[model samples]
Target: MMNKHTQVIRIIMIATLQLFALRNTFSQATAQRPNIIYMMSDDHAYQAISAYGYGLNQTPNIDKLAEQGVLFKRAYVTNSICGPSRAVMLTGKFSHVNGFTDNHSTFDGNQQTVAKLLHNSGYTTAVIGKWHLVSDPQGFDYWNVHPGQGDYYNPDFIENGIRKRVEGYSTNLVTDFAIKWLDQRDKSKPFFLIYQQKAPHRNWMPEPKYYHLFDSVQFPVPANFFDDYSTRTSAAREQEMEIARHMTDTYDLKLAFDLPKESQRGLNSLWTSIYNRLTPEEKQKWEEAYKPSNDAFYKAHLSGKELAIWKYQRYMKDYMRCVQSVDDNVGRLMDYLKANGLDKNTIIIYTSDQGFFLGEHGWFDKRWMYEESFRTPLIVKWPGVTNKKVVTESMVQNVDFAETILEMAGLPIPTDMQGKSFVPLLKGKQKGNVHDALYYHFYENQEHKVAKHIGIRTDRYKLICFYEKNEWELYDLQKDKSEMHNVYNDPAYGKVQAEMKQKLLELKKQYKDPVPEIIP
Candidate 1:
């Protein structure tokens, strides 16, 4: 017979063993799974964010993510246009490889996507807003997207198969829908949610409530806000996206009217209708207290040079207003995550469809190989996974996002993806550098009149060759971050330029770029 002390010890040992076995099984089941929340803003610029040090605008929520995680100093898009960049991001390939080189180019829904891969690997995936790829969004279990650009108010959302017009601010409505989906989704499984916002895109119009948020302050002008595009190449000289020239009074951005003309009456009516829809106290304050000096200029009958300056001021003001609203919505989302206890487990990313030229090259829209339009802001926050307050100067491309997502979840990268994972860098592995160099190709021959160009950006310099113009422009980024001066033809930098050209040629061959005969 066993002694009483021995029997008690044996009972305790059995209970402990059973508990260990249950814990091991639970950990195994939960391992290799994480929740992903990818958020993208439309036409947002790297310079606009306070974290990037432009300091013209404030983005506290986005900056908070950077404070808590890693901030990528040099993040680029495959193509500098909305549609193609988005497609490249989804497919983890270049614009040429994905067959979406322009706004008009349609995306084949059958293509392999990060969403599909995540779904197949036992994750529930959903895309909430702005699917501009011109295809029925594939790989997502649920999708609610803007028709195109979308409306500031009373926007139409194509959810599943039905096109329903939702009456609310685009940003708020999109977020509400996203939160609803989060609330209703299967709690037992991991989820991948893409919350894309259409706010701050072209013709930056904000909701009535957000319109006057930044009215009291005068936004500072960019140092190169009045760039002449003189020292740059011929391609820069030929572009038509100038803030002083191309901004119109009618289309997307319209200012207040002093004395409504017959033509202005229609716009006035719309503004009044929008204003009247607001609460009585809100409308009273907007009409009586809020008076924009821009209205007086718009009401003036000026011609030639005076009119051009007036338009630039109006454009800048309205554009910043749109951005202000976007910043607010970003704050709202961050607050939701923190309040719900999802902040710690979730990884949040913020970026744009592509970089926008905020009058940097005297340009408004993107689709150029220039640095302002090519580079975008990328911020990632993963609690306990990424070190706090880290800034990685390594070159990272938008295409790499897909592979990085897979790697974060411990999933195998697809063979078709051209991008490599940067998860190791986030985890403090620091393999010297993330990329030796980055490649950029923009094939969209669009409204800007910029020709097809393929370029390479090394740590120190950028080399771009305009295929149609038969021209080359080089910039030494180490010395010239503004890219105000071109040194392609300078004899002093001849050796550096020549080496970059050869590297470009080698990359073209490696990436199978279809452009024939890289002109030296």
Candidate 2:
């Protein structure tokens, strides 16, 4: 009935309308996907954060996140060490399953990770800062990571597989690179960015502006600062992490004049290596800040318990100063997000690899399953999803990180992943804890002399097995908050011990850990 030209024109008009509809659908879907920013700091203790209420130091920026989102009170790690905990976070599995059980093992990046899954699902992925798994990052569109436990001043970063030294403090440099990546990324695609920091770790070194930040204020020591390890197993007494005997003057206290002839743990030489990396101008500023304190120490000639207290003061000040810098940089990143109007569509997660000891039980490092070392700080801010200023004691661990992120991105979780997603809990559709019991194991025992141990933590009880030593320790957390008293042999707790032991075995089976059988 119609001419050939008219028929062709009608066909072309219909085709154009269909193509425009398809593009509109794609735009809506992309807008629904939230951009993710995962920020982590090394060895940041929960007690040091003002939001946690210990009041050791003020972290106003980190606390602002808590006030706006959810603050998790009982968040913990799969392992208390650095590399293994990170591996768990990436794969949603324990260290043994991830094949990265210790710091010495290289991560098998070929395996499935959350980053890989997201990248495959059309999201751009990038990781910047400390990647200590001893292997090149995989599943990332861009990566610029630290070589090892990165230096505080003038650090080196391996950018896109080429190593180069960047001038400036490590914390500031990491944040700068993150902002740069966000600015230049593809606007059509949603992104996932890992912004990690190397501050507030061991051998704490603050920036020039923070060197004299806490000079006048004296921090209060923990109630059990002088623990004798009286009732616990031989494992506690044998560890080499005691602050009094193990902490050195030059390396830890930053005293340049009084160098011991024999350095404890060979740390003085390591300190000298780090200090020598500073420029002449930096060195002058450092000396100017520390000289007055060094002179007072020399004049006092203190020793014994008095000297130990002085070391504690010095350690806390330097550690708190480093923490302050991390808080400042967090504020910087937040401002960037707000300025660009990304705050309305971005989800922010702030946490640490593991907790550190600040004179708790006279210890300085993390390894033991004590509360200070085991519990990590977790804060999540989701603009439209989470209830404002929510605080929950729902137990969650590092292993759940991968699965949770995948669910947030509306991607299907891999069947082999072991972690349970906490999206329902976040949405208020689920109540109570996400996990009934959590399992933990530490494989590296050579460094801090903490015996290789496996443990299980429930809501009310904890049971530990020092398998190599054939020892067991149990603690009723409700009664003994400090874990100072071990009740393994107490007759009153006979039923509790038996129940906890059975639960531990069940957890080991559920997680597929091939631990040796314990002789009861």
Candidate 3:
């Protein structure tokens, strides 16, 4: 009914209004930095998350985040150990550059951290839950942390340098305290929160509420659960972690015998207190859940491959149960954000310090350059940007986490930081050269008897040097995805090996790692 000029004018007006609305949204977002909730779970393997399609277990709550935003397909960590990985995430640098090579070393708190940068930029910072770097957290206005690895039940927490005992499950307590801080934070300014989870770390501790989760469930054992370590170096053979051999009944399985510390296993007071602090009803429930299985196992005297399968079943169920709590607690946090109207103004990231072995290659712990241990799971929900689910094949390391958070806040990354921010990749900008390969280093000598190694993973090739034993391993990920066959000596791919070795040296040099260790 309108004239041609009038119709053109109407079209321009509609387009102009839409553009204005978009600019207004962008302006409001610019005025306030996004609140960051970085949730790093301990030893949460990608193979277990349903989003990854491994289907080891169902993680509905965690899958929600992946469905809502970007789920990284090839995320990894600079170091596979806990403390060093956390340290690297904090500093935006590799283990060698940050000086936290392994769990044994101390994290210098005075050094610059992402928390410090955020704090300086008018963002309130808080780090709750597991902070295993052995340094009292600096730069955080409020930090409530677990001492060492922390206890699963009735755990003691060090809050702002004051130790306090909270009577509840560790995962729930962490959420409770984090919410308390959130309620107390300055609403006028944005915030950054590190909600780290200590769940499913070691001893496979699960909350009493989830004690019987997988009681009747039967899990299939890994194809290589009975790996003979054949054709591999002593590092693979001598490793001290295995579901069949290393998992202890006294320390790891909660069979109380009051054995000596070393003879019992690793860390008892926490695992022991879990049972000691259980209510009568809770204790009865736990006994009811585990008694039949424990008694049957002790009487069976499981050995050989039969014993291995039994151990695998027990380990898988307990580990999965612990994982369920993490998913639930993560849901709790996400619910809090949504209920508080913070979801749209926040950036939520779910990942782990490093990946754990869920019975892959007959291994239990992370530290090797194997895919299971080397790759970490990362799902990020950045509201107003990656609002829909998207998956990226680009390689991202935990070290980049700090710089990414910094970049999201429109801040410059410190020159000392070795990692480049992948915010461009997250926003689908189709810009920036992120990474073609990732470098990894492990330097622990005896905790798990894993070889100290340095490695690099390219798009389809992986080269690792177990310099401690002068052992080299190469895997063609496209051809042998399982990494079961080492092809370093294959004449057919001699050039590929040489190219990977060159890249490894270049990365080590660029990252300032010890290059001398790479030589055969």
Candidate 4:
């Protein structure tokens, strides 16, 4: 009955109305969803956080999350290494399932990841800072990642597949990019940001301003700083991560002023390369900070225990200084959130890829089944959800991160994702530990000579299997929290050992991990 012109106009009007209605519906849904800011630091140990009561250093900004929301006591990693832990976090699966079992492996981008899941669900997702996965990040709408284990000074980052070297300290630059992304992100949809930091990792380097921040403070050495691996497995003794023996003067302690010429062969070249990356101004600051210490080390002929203590002090100070910068940047990010009024509706989760050894068991690196390396720091600040400061002893792992984020955003967790959502725990609907027993497997055998191992940790007991060596170790955590003794052969723990072994087998099956052949 209508003319051609009138029919065309009517069709266009209906289409426009439908589009508007759909957009309005999406906007209302997005408003109800809490925005997620997942902040992770590399090799950040639980012992380093003041909120954990270790008192090694003060992280006031990180502690604020603990004061306002929830602090997880037993937050562990599926694997206690950088790349694999991150892969587990993204996929909510074990290392075997994710296909990134170690640092050397490239992350399979085609697989389902939290970023992809969130992006597909209409949430604007971005990942900034250290993406050590060895491949271009996929599923993220925006990605600015470190090329590899990014340098601490004047690092190169790959932004949306475009590589460019940025002139600034790595931690600060990472934060800057994150803030910039937030400012320009789509405001109509809920955002999920993976804001990460590369501070406090290996070869610790702080911002110039914080280079000597911990100079005056003499940190207390761990009680077992002079650990003799008499009772432990052969793997413990074979480890090349000992602070006294393995830590290099040139590379680790930054003591290059007076060293034997022959001592400059191995790691010195690498150290020299890193030192060369610094700008003139940065080099000046570094030289000024370490000159006095280097001079004193050369003057005082410290050897044996005294030399180890000196190395310990230098390592601790440098590491803590880097941690201080990370904390400062966290405060910066928090301030930005509050200023933009994003604090009220956003959920901030601060954690680490995995924990590190802070002179624990006389070691300086991670990848052990030991508590220091296995346990990471997790602090969640969920506005409108968490009303008061709650310290939970509930055992959660990095593998659970993806599911938790998805559930918090009111999205259905994919069936393929292996982690259980802790939304019930967060909402106070459930109590105690979410996991009955936590499984861990470390596949990397090249670095620091930490033997490839599989392990299980229950509430009060831990069982480790160095399957390659046909060796088993058990720790009664309630009795020996430091894990100074192995009770696997103790007659009194026979029943406990049997139970743990059975449980371990069950867990291996449950996680779909293949049992390594023990050459018994």
* lDDT-sorted candidate list, best first: 4, 2, 3, 1
TM-scores, one per candidate:
0.87, 0.96, 0.91, 0.96
C-alpha lDDT score of every prediction, in listed order: 0.79, 0.90, 0.86, 0.90
Candidate 3 per-residue C-alpha lDDT over 35-147 given as tens digits, one digit per residue, 9 for 90 to 100 = 99999999999988999998678999999999888999888998898999999999998887788999989999898999999998878899999999998999998999999
Q: Write the per-residue lDDT of candidate 2 for residues 1-520, one digit (tens) a residue.
A: 8799999999999999999999888778976799999999999999889999997789999998988888999999988988888888889999989999988899999999999998888889999999898999999999999998989888999999999988899989999999999999887889999888998888899988999998998899788889999989999999999888888778888888334557533788888878877888888888899999989999999998888889999999999999999999999999999999999888999999988899999989898888889999999998898748888899999999999999999999888899898888888788899998889888888888999999999999999999999888999999999999999979999999999999988888899999657664
lDDT digits (tens) for residues 1-520 of candidate 4: 9999999999999999999999998889877789999999998888889999988899999999888888999999989999998999999999999999999999999999999988898889899999899988999889999988888998999999999998999999999999999999998888999998988898997788987787889899899888898888898999999999999888898887334556657678777778888888778878898898789889999999999989999999889999998999999999999999999999999999988888878889899989999999999989988878999999998899999999998888888888889989988899999899999999989979989999899999999999888788999999899999999989999999989998888888888887575422
Clashes of each: 0, 0, 0, 0
Clashes of 1: 0
2 or 3, greater by lDDT: 2
Poorest lDDT segment (10 consecutive residues) of candidate 2: 257-266
- Residue 374's lDDT within candidate 2 is 92
TM accuracy, model 3: 0.91
Task: Please give the lDDT score at residue 103 for candidate 3.
Answer: 91
Give me candidate 2's TM-score against the actual structure.
0.96
Q: Which pairs clash in the backbone of model 2?
A: none
